[model samples]
Target: MGTYRYRVQTSGFGLFLGIAAEATRLTNPPTMNVPVSNRVWLDASEVNNAFHGNRLALNEREVAWLRVGLDKVSGDIERIETSPYILISVRALEIFEVDYAEEALAPAIAGWATREFTLTPRLCNVSRDSDTGQFTFDWNE
Candidate 1:
């Protein structure tokens, strides 16, 4: 065919321990197998936490400096506010190579191969496949 659109995966935006589940892990792992189009998700986190952990290590001198200036920060868990996630359905052209004469108008993987999605903290959840028993499939953008 020319091009096709599939409901790769549907995720529910939620949070886990202040961290969106999808933030830690997306239904479709960010890789070639999993295309950016497959990044379908919905903002379902009304009470989402979306917490992230950051580190600021300090040496003895640094600690002493911070102590001197009262710039020391120590705590158990830090709370970070992140954006919500939305459920989205993705469809891409499955690249089919025929010959130099003919080419399909599907998801193309030519010069542009690698891609990235700037996902804030948001719990994205997609149920595993029941028939094939797959959490999700792989795609590329």
Candidate 2:
């Protein structure tokens, strides 16, 4: 199996992100709404492959369980295959330095959003951090 990468999006300002991949899809039937001029709420769907050229963040064991698009994930480890796994959070402006943090759980370029997906064949931080602001991601287990 081949693990793919993706980011979660939300309507922080106006229209959020949508996934439109070949096999990826929304979880269920969606409802239409016009909150203010044009608005929606809690709308979750795997629209298209917006991150087709993105990178993977997984290990050999995990990569063995990866597929192209959305596949169910069953574990949570920080780094794999020398690459780091990230656990993205609520804030949109935060970023994990490539070579600093052990793994980076960063939000997509679209900005603030909430999503659930895993990236395999992780990316390694190929830098040497010598500054104070630089932080490293670590896994206790």
Best by lDDT: 2
Model 1, 21-137: lDDT tens per residue? 122234333332212222322221231211223232323442232122111111000112122221211122221122210111111111011111221222222345457643331
Per-residue lDDT of 1-141 in model 2, one digit per residue for the tens?
112233322232111222221211223322441111111112122122223533333343322212211112212222121222222111111222222121222212111221233334333222224565442322111
RMSD of each: 22.6, 17.1
For each candidate, give its TM-score against the true structure.
0.16, 0.17
Deviation in Å, model 1, residue 83 alpha carbon: 2.4
Q: Worst lDDT window (10 residues) for model 2? A: 33-42
lDDT of 1 at 47: 19
For all candidates in order, the CA lDDT equals: 0.21, 0.23
The Cα error of candidate 1 at residue 24, in Å, is 18
